[model samples]
Target: MRKLFSIIGLFVSCLLAAQEEEWRVIPSVREWLEEINNWPDSVYRQDNLHVFFDYEKDTGLIATTFEETDSLPSEPLFIVNKPVRVSGLNFAGDRKGPGTMPRRLTSIQFNGWLTISRMAQNRAGFVGCVFKDDMSMWDIQSRNVLQFVDCDFEKSLHLYGPQENMGFYIANTSIKEDLIITSGNTDAGIRILNSDLSQFFVNGKFTQFRMDSTNVRYGMRLSNVTISNSFQLQNTSLPALELIGTDFPELHTYIPFHNIENALALDLPIGWDRDQDLVKYKAESKEEIMDTQRFDNLIASYYTLLEVYKSRGELTSYNACYIEMRDKVTARSKLLYNQDPSFTNFFAYQINRFTRAFSDYGTRPEKAIIVFFQVVLAFSIFYFFFPSSWNTTNNRTMMRRLSYLGSYFTSKEGLSDLFEKEAKEDYKDYEEFHQFISSSEKRLPIYFQWLSKPLYRVSVSRFNLSRRLLASGDILKGEWDQLPKAKQVRTSILIGLYLVIYLIYVLIIRCLNAITLSLNAFSTLGFGEIPTRGLARYVTIIQGFVGWFLLSIFLVSLIGQILN
Candidate 1:
C-alpha cells in the first residue's frame, strides 16, 4: 500500500512541474496583482524576471491600467515578486526578432504617472514593451535591477528614489523626455545602448552612465562623470556641458567643457553664404550684444531653459532657445573681439580666416608655408628690380636695366665669364660636364650610381651656361661705352680680382649659407656678415629696413596660426 502511494505522489509532482512551466494567459490587471502577490520564494529568482511563461499566450500579453478616479496609494501599479524577462517587447505585433518568437505587441498603458517600485531581490524587466505615458520608479531596493530592451517610453522617466547598488540596462529604446535622477545611487550604474534621449542628468553625482551609439539632443549636464570607476559614453554625439569634474572618458564629439574659455576653435563664415563682394563681411548677424556681466547671467539662464525645454521633448521650443542662445553668444564674442584694440583678437580672426578657410578651425600648416613662400617671392621681385646704383655715373638715377625676360635664364657667374676674357655665346665646358654624367651612368654599376648622386646634384646645381650667355648678352647690349679693345683690357684686370673673391665667397657660402647671411640681412638682428665690395651694402641696408616691417607682421601671423 505504501509503494503504490509513493509512485502516485511522484507522478503528481511531475505533472505539477509541467504545469508551472506552461505559458498561462494573463487576465485583467487585478488578476495579475493577485497572481504574483503570493508567489513562492523558489518560483521568483532575484535579479531575474521569468515572465515568458508567466503570461498565458505569446500573441497578446498586455498590462491593464487603473482609472484616474481610483485613489491608490503611491504603491507601484504591479508588485511583482516573480522573475520577469525583457524577452517579448514587439512593436510590429508579429514578434519577429532575434531571441524572440512570433508574438503580438506587448502594450502597457497607465492612467497618468506610472510607478514601478521594486524592493528586496525582486527586479522588473520589460522587453518589446511600450509605455503610453510617463514612467517613474518610486524606490528601487539594493541589488535590484530594472532593464528594458526594444521599449518605447512615450514620455519622461524619473529614477530618483532608487537605493544603492541598483542597476539598469536600456537599449534600442527612445525616451521622449528626460532620463532624470534627482538622488539615490551610491556605486550604482546605468547602461544605455543605441538609444535616444533629449537630456540626461544625475543631480551632480557620480553614478556612471555608460552608453554607446546613443544620441542626446541637449547632452548631459552631470558634475562628475569621470569620478565613476567605469564611465563610458563611446561613439555618442552628446556634448559635455559640465565644465568642472566631468568628461566623456571615452569616444565623444565637440570640444570639452574645460576648453570653452579659449576662443571657439572655429572660424565663422563672413555671412551665411560665400560672396565675391566684401560687403558680406560687414553684415552683422545680430544687431546688438549685451554687456559682459548681463550676457553671462543671461546665458546661464538661457542654457537652463534650453536644457529644460529639451528634456520636455519640446522640439520647437528647444530649437528656439538654442538658436537664440547661439546668436547671443556669437554677437557677444564679436563684441569682445572688436572692443579690444590688442592685436590679439584681430589677427586671431584674420589669420585663421585664411589658414583655416573661415569655416572649420582645423589647422593647415601647409597654407601657412605657402603664404610664407608667396611673401618671399614678392621680396625676391623687389630685389630683382632694385637698382645696381653705383655702376652708373649718376648713382641716384641708376636703374637696374636688365630685361625681366632675360633674368629668367641668367646668373652673375656666366655674365662675368662672357664680359671679361671668355667672351662666347656657347659654353663647351658646361656641355662636356652634362654629357659626362649622361654617358657615365649607363656603364656604371648600381653601387656606382649611388655614389654618383652627390656628383649629379653638384652637376645640376650649376647654372646652364647657354642661358647665362643669352642673359649676359642682354646685360651688355645697350651702351655707347663700346671701346671694346681698351674696355676689354680694363675689364680683364677687374675680372681677375673679382673671380678670386667670388670663388672664395662661393666656397665659404655653401648653398645653405642663406640661413646665416640671408637671415642676418633679413632682420634687425645685428649679427652681420661682410659682403665683398659691390651693390651688396646698399642692398643690405634697404633689405634690413623693409624686412623689419614684413618680419614683424609675419611673426604676429605665425603666432596666431600656432595658437589658433
Candidate 2:
C-alpha cells in the first residue's frame, strides 16, 4: 500500500510539471466582475472577450466592462491565471448615454505589460470605438486623451487611465516617465505621455498612422523614423525631425520632432532631384574596371613626375604636386562614394579603406618602398609607347568647370537666373552631358600619352648623355645649367637636358596617379598592386636615371684621359 501511494505521488508531480495555465472567456460584464472579485492576488491571463464597455453599472472601479445585454448570466465571472494572447479584440457594440457619456471606459489600466504585437492587423474594419478611458494621473497630465479619440486610434492607441490599474500598463512603474505604447509592425510605433499637462512624446512609423495636421493634436508630437512616405505638413512645430537617405526634397516627406538643445543632422538637397542627378553623375563617371587599370597608370606617370620635381626642390613644383595628389586622392574617393550622406562621403570611404590597408602590411619602410616601386614599373610599361596619355590639364579643367556649375545652383538669387537658362534646354536631357564626362574619362590615356612623349626623349638622352656629364671633370654644378657656348653649338644637347628633367617630373606624377587610382578602383588590392605598377612605371622613370649614371661614368673616363 505504501509503494502504491509513492507511485501515485510521482505521477501527480509529473502531471503538474507538464500543465499549462488556461485562458477564461467572459461574455458578460457581470461575469467578468465575479471572476475579478474572487481572483487570487497572483497573476492571471484573460482572453476571448467579444466586447468590453466602461459603464457605471454599480462598481466604482471595475477592471473590465461592456454595454447592457439580454440573456446574461445571473452572476457570472471568470478568472484566468496564465500568460494569454488573444487572437482578436473587437469593441463594435454601442451603448446609450449622455452626449458627454464616455462611449468607452474612461479609465482603463494594467498592472503588468500589455504588449500589442501587431496593431495594424488588430485594427482592421473597426470604427467609432472608444480606444481608451483614462482618469489615471498619467492620463490627466498627458493632455493627449482627446488626441487618442480624434486621431486614428485604431492604428496605434495607448490610452492611459488610472495609475493603479495593472492589466494594460506594461511599463516599469518605478520609471518616472509616461506609459509606453510599443507597436511591432514593419513600422515600429510608439505613443508615450507620462503625467497630466505633460507633452505627448510620439515616435516610430508615422506612415502607419497617416496622422496629418487635420487629425493630430497640438500636444502630440512625433520624431525619429527609419523611413517615411508621408509629406511634412506646413506650420507644424516638431522640433525633433530628421530625414535619412539621400536628399529627395520634392517628394512627400515629414520631419521628426527634436528637442531644442539636441541638434539633428538635417539633409537639404544641394542639387535638384538630387538622387536621380547623383545616379546620372555616378553613371557618367563610372569607368569600366578594365579602363581604370589604364587610368591608374596615367596617374602613376604624373606621380613619378611629381617626385622628380620634389627631388629638384622646386616649391612651385611641390605645390603643383600637392594639388595633383589631392586630385588623385579625390578621384579615388569617388569610386566608393557611398560612405556618408554628404559630398565627402565617397572620398572619405576610399581614404579610409586605403588607410586601413596602409596601416597593415605597409607599416615598414622597405615594404612601402617595394610597393611604390612596383607600381611605377607596371604603369611605365603600360604607357611606355603612349607617354603623352598622362596629361591632366583637361581633367583638372573639367572638374573645375563642374564645380562652377554646382556653385551656379547654390543660391536662391541665382537659382532663378540659372533655371531660366536651364529651362531653355531640357534639364532632363542628360545624354550630351553624360557623353562629355564619359569621353573625358575614356580620354584619360590620351593625356598621359602626350605627357609621356617628351618624357621618352628625355629618358633616352639621360641614359646616354647625362651619365657621361656627371662622370666628367668638366661636368659639375655648372652642368646642371646649360652652357652659353652650347647655346651656339649643342642646341640639340641643351634640349636633351630639358627633356631629362621634364621626363623625370612627368614620370613621378604618373607613378603617383597610377597607384592612387588603382587603390580607388580595387580597394584593398590597390596597396597590394602598388609594387606591381610602381615597379613597371619606375622602369621608365628610372631609365632616365640609368642614363644619367651612364653619362656620368663616360664623362669621368673622358676627363681622366684629358687630365693624364
Report lDDT (CA) for all predictions. Answer: 0.47, 0.35
- What would you estimate as the lDDT of candidate 1? 0.47
lDDT, candidate 2, at 289? 19
Candidate 2 similarity to native, TM-score: 0.24
Measured against the true structure, the TM-scores of the candidates, in listed sequence, are 0.45, 0.24
lDDT of 2 by residue, 480-559 (tens): 23346655256445535754775577567765655454333322222333333444445444544543433344445345
lDDT of 2: 0.35
For residues 1-564, write the lDDT of model 1, one tens digit per residue.
999999999999999987754543343333443454455652422222223322334323332212211332233333334433221111121123332322222333333345545432334455555565667665565354556666677677777656666677788889876677644436566788999876566653444666778887544555433334445546675433332234332322222222222211111221121123212111133332434454454466455444544444544444444444555555555566787856777665455344233212222334444554454455444443432222221223222222321332243333544433332323455457557756887887878767666665564445444446556544334331343767646655564565477555543443224334445556567644554236656766766776675555556545644543
> Largest lDDT belongs to which candidate?
1
Which numbered prediction scores highest in TM-score against the true structure?
1
* Poorly placed runs, candidate 2 (over 4 Å): 1-25, 29-34, 52-88, 92-103, 109-229, 233-250, 254-262, 265-564
Per-residue lDDT, model 2, residue 180, is: 34
